[model samples]
Target: MLYVKIHQLSERKFKITQIAKELKISRPTVYKYLGMTYEEVKQLLEDPHRKARKLDPYRDWIIAWLEEYPHLSAAQIRDWLLERYPDMEVGESTVRSYVRELREIYQIEKKNIVRQYEAVPEQPMGKQLQVDWGETKQKTINKKEVKLYFIAFVLAHSRLKYMEWQNRPFTTRDAIRCHENAFQYYGGRTEEIVYDQDHLITVSENAGQLLLTTEFQSYVNERKFKIHLCRKADPESKGMIENVVKYIKGNFADSRVFSNIDDWNKRALQWLERTGNYHVHQTTKKRPAEVFLVEKQHLKPVSSLLSFESNHEQSITRNVGKDNTVRFKSNRYSVPLGTYNSATDNQVYIKIKTGKRQTLEIRKQLEGEIIAEHLISLEKGKLIQNRNHTRDRSKGIEEYKEHLISRFKDQEQGRTYLNEICLKYARYRRDQLAIIHRVIQEDPGWIDEALTKCLKEKLYSANDFRDMVQYFKNLKVAPVRNKMNDSKGPKHAKGMIVTTRSLDAYTSILGGAAQ
Candidate 1:
């Protein structure tokens, strides 16, 4: 073929350089091939005995595997070789070259089996809506890649789409909030909503019963919408929204340099107006925005938005660092000292107030009480701390120590042990005092014993003191607890039900022994 192309190009009066450029080959090679006849070229190039390749010994195996699994790639073949023969030494490039040669020589063409999808009949307006999630990595203003997750909602009938993006993964609360936004954007809600069995909403599916997350279940009940959770590995059931997700990623998100999330969302809305909902859909052949006008009338009126534990307050959980700070949007905000408990998890709830200038209210996990609040910062890597939160909560350590010592029988010994703990763990004095104070509250009887043992053994830590207290408490004999009296129990139950004249009967039976 090379000899034919070279001679044919020469007969057509084409220059050697032009032939080499057209064929993407070097000029010297073109000239060398042009010098040989077809028969001579075949003899030299198709020589039976060529140099053996590193992968030549496995050529038959590669050919067999390729013939069996036509879609197998060269990298997969290299992995299989390494897996099968641990001692084999081969490079990726060598395997790729060998695989290509084998495929070409043996005519083993790779086949890609595209999944067959049959179009389902479109539902009536507001009858159904499909929901799906998508994610993409895009460049920021600084050219750094940032991953953005998004949820897409599309009307099954009109294909009108709505989507929201965030820098973090969607939690159940986030998903519920997004649903409210979608309902407001569409001006109404659908009778039933379809989902992809995502954990953000559905917790589990058992025997055809779908169990949704607590928050999501409440949202669904409030919205009064039926949920249709698609089976696992079956995205085709909700293909409408799946395609919408793809459309958003490819057209709206692709190549768009993201700045702040607010700006990105603003741009996304603009794109939806000009392109996404405005442009003609390939399958429907009509603009989604136009179809939405007619479908909007049939949609059920959207009820008031859900209160996610607070009115318009978006809540998310974050881990408090050892330094008593929680990170949000690359900036750290201070919580009060003692917020981070290593024994338990350090997760705290961050409630974002909805307004023009957002304020973050960091709350304790269990009580949901606001521990700290700060105006949200737009800048990155900043510490937006409150001066009050940074106050040394351990400033009252002297008074707290004295109060705890007063509870001990030997106040001087208590003071000495606490002072030693402070000297040894200056940074952890507050934690030590807290543990000792809790131990004192539980049982001050063991304090003298534990303090004496700790002082004698030179165990200066609060943990050792607590452990010693526990040991001493366990050694003390437990008080005898009397059984409950039925007369003092609930009024509904019978109390002992003893017959009358019991004393008289006993006296008569023991008449001889009465004395």
Candidate 2:
């Protein structure tokens, strides 16, 4: 009561005993009021008016600047304010505090204002799993280069993580492979996989909704797994996996030197088992591995569909020859002798199949029937000539002669004469010689007859042999009686014709002609 009377007086000059006696209260109560001085009373009265010390003198300007550029950091704002007002000294902590206050106020009044995201409640056990790609610096297999990119996954409740090295560019194949590997590593599959909308898995902008890629969706459907895609750019939606990535980068990958990507992934898995799974979680205070053991019972058993199946479609095309064979990748693949002449109006379609190795199989489909098949090689400038149809004659005369002799052993004399003609033509054009050599190999008996006819006609050029062959096919012989009459008499008698009237006369004439 004395303390109350002292507070009512607004003066601190009263003695503790005098106040206690006057108010008839306990001495301790009087002592409580007498402890405060006059200045303390004045300070208490003016508490509302004591302007809160400006944590940042230029806070208003900084807030306005931040409104224009939300990405600007506290240090950046401090530097900018110092530039504008040389006398205004602002620390990064003060700027951060002002921005934080602005954020809190904006969040309270404006529902649409961007704020720090909080993760949604996760279901217990195998209801959901989070997946994400994490990157860490690592040495390559040859120890000559450093690379990055590691795909990581985490169970929502248990926080048990699965990770693997993905050193190459991200693709649909890589995404599917990572999912299959992660499920196997976890020993079971969750009911659903929760993922941030990555282009590799989603393939298209979801218009602010969830949409999975066709290939990825097919993969999930085959295993009877549900697909859950998070909002775009919201990494916290799959916070468990994101946190695992950060933790692994800091605890394992930062200081470790791995000889290869496999080695790095092996070390990461070991660390997850030893450091991450065995360690107690900060909030739950339970070992992740122990929690996972309970969660494992809820997970679905592994499906029979193993990973790494071929997802490629097949196509086919026919290659038209530059001369008489189809050429692909600098290699000549032969078709039948006149196949191209009949296929002038058709278009050839090529087929491609996808797997660990890219296999390109070329086929010619005519009237829905495959006519030819050839394999393509990747070596530059290497010719792949079809040995079943043609021979390479680029080696010169001795090689050509040996080839001709081997093909025409039944007519050695004729083959020798043809070799002489090929040599004579080789003096003018080497390619012409190869053509002549091929002609001789095709029919050796035609060589001696062609050469003797050429000699009788004084043929010297390669064209002369062609002309002589044409003439020999068209040559006509006159009857012997008409020839003798023309030799004995005049040219006028050549107009008369003789005909056999009886079968015996005609038979005698046929026998003489045959002899």
Candidate 3:
């Protein structure tokens, strides 16, 4: 508690003596904790310099040299100590033991300490936040027994919590995205954040030194926030966030039925406001939202960092295809007409940030103008197009009708038939015009008197019109005479007229002579 107050006072640029006087502590104690980060103070408290050793007098000096040159061998460290303390009475055995201890303790700047957590004192508002992820099997609308993952970031001071869910195991980029949202939800970020040595962040330890993954390291450098890594297999270190995760599962998600992921998230956000933040916290005896207003004062302003997410740099470029869309990964997203086509002869390159459940923004490469935006789909070969992109309806039937009229103006009957079909199937002008073209090409008079007769029945499909034309063609009239010079045949004289089968009145002879 004194350490935190001293550190806080130092952050406000208080002098060491002033902080000591204000907090009623000695000047030396204030100086000790003043410049140290939260992680460093946590490490110091976990493993203090309380052990008495035979080479205790030289421990500080030896550890300092070892920390400075971690590459130095034990023999080299011993020699350096001897040169500094020529009159010292420490033997080689005592020196070796002390050097080994120093390497184990002080060689690494930060060590992951493993121990059971004691009952922690309440932290001042906006001092720290604990972060962790929880997983559970949930059934969604289309998916059954899905592995649902949620990240919980709980403020140690106000007992305020923020939760975000994902359908998959979180990557380093996803975790950073979660942090960005959590900070935004809190309206500001805490001075320090605690984690459980997440594999996405921590790669591996090298000689007891906790090494952050390259991607996470870059993120940390950009964000510039303090990180406190908990000991392995130790949930008690970040007990608050762990409890919040459990509470979310039991109270919020246990009996809730999910219609879809989007609705579920919307309800979850509402639940956080209503039940999670509005209720009085058992520990703080105040509503988290109310306490958060006070915590907001002490918090580092969110404006100090970037307003948007930090891990959105991984982008792939793609050219716009002939369909006025750019294929990113496997799916295609629509852009404007002038953006890409043969007329311009210039390519529109779009940058794609790929992910599941991703909102893709299509920006112009040169101007950085957003041409289009769409929700990214996981399914391949999908063209995610917006109807507003190509909204010109007159470009189709109005323009094409003139061309058709000009092509067959000489055929007066065909032109009249085209006009009739267009007016009759006005709602389906495109389809009816296309069918008129096919009929004109195949058989000019196929839609002659029969079309006029069929218009009374009001048939509208292109296929039905085609089938009617074929039925008209099949109804060939029988010639009265099959003679060589039979120009005046019965069907030729009167011209053929088709008739439907009158089933009930048709006279049929049983053996050709019984009629």
Model 3 TM-score relative to the real fold: 0.38
Model 1 per-residue lDDT tens digits across residues 1-515 = 55676778889999989987666556887788778787887887568686767887787888788887676767557655764676798776888778866664454666544655558887998899899999999889998999999999999988888888999888767787788888899999999999997767765787779877555676777788998988888777877887788778755675557898888777677667755786578788999999999999989997674554563255676778988899999999998655565543455678878798999988754345688999999999999888765534665989888888898767889889999999998998877787777677766667777888899999998878877887888898232223356567533322234345756677888774444
Better of 1 and 2 by lDDT: 1
The per-model lDDT (C-alpha) reads 0.77, 0.59, 0.66
Query: For each predicted model, how many residue pairs clash, with residues at least 3 apart or on different chains?
Result: 0, 9, 0
Candidate 3: segments with Cα more than 4 A from true spot: 1-118, 141-143, 206-208, 304-312, 315-515
lDDT (0-100) at residue 185 of candidate 2?
A: 75
TM-score, structure 1 vs. true: 0.45
lDDT for model 3, please.
0.66
User: What TM-score fits each model?
Assistant: 0.45, 0.40, 0.38
As a whole number from 0 to 100, the lDDT of residue 435 in candidate 1 is 71
**In angstroms, how far off is 95's CA in candidate 1?**
42
Q: Model 2, range 401-502, lDDT digits (tens) per residue?
A: 566556432456535555556666666444444445545544444544565666665564445554344344445322122234565664332435655487
Error of 2 at 377 (Å): 6.8
- Give candidate 1 misplaced runs (Cα > 4 Å): 1-116, 305-308, 311-515
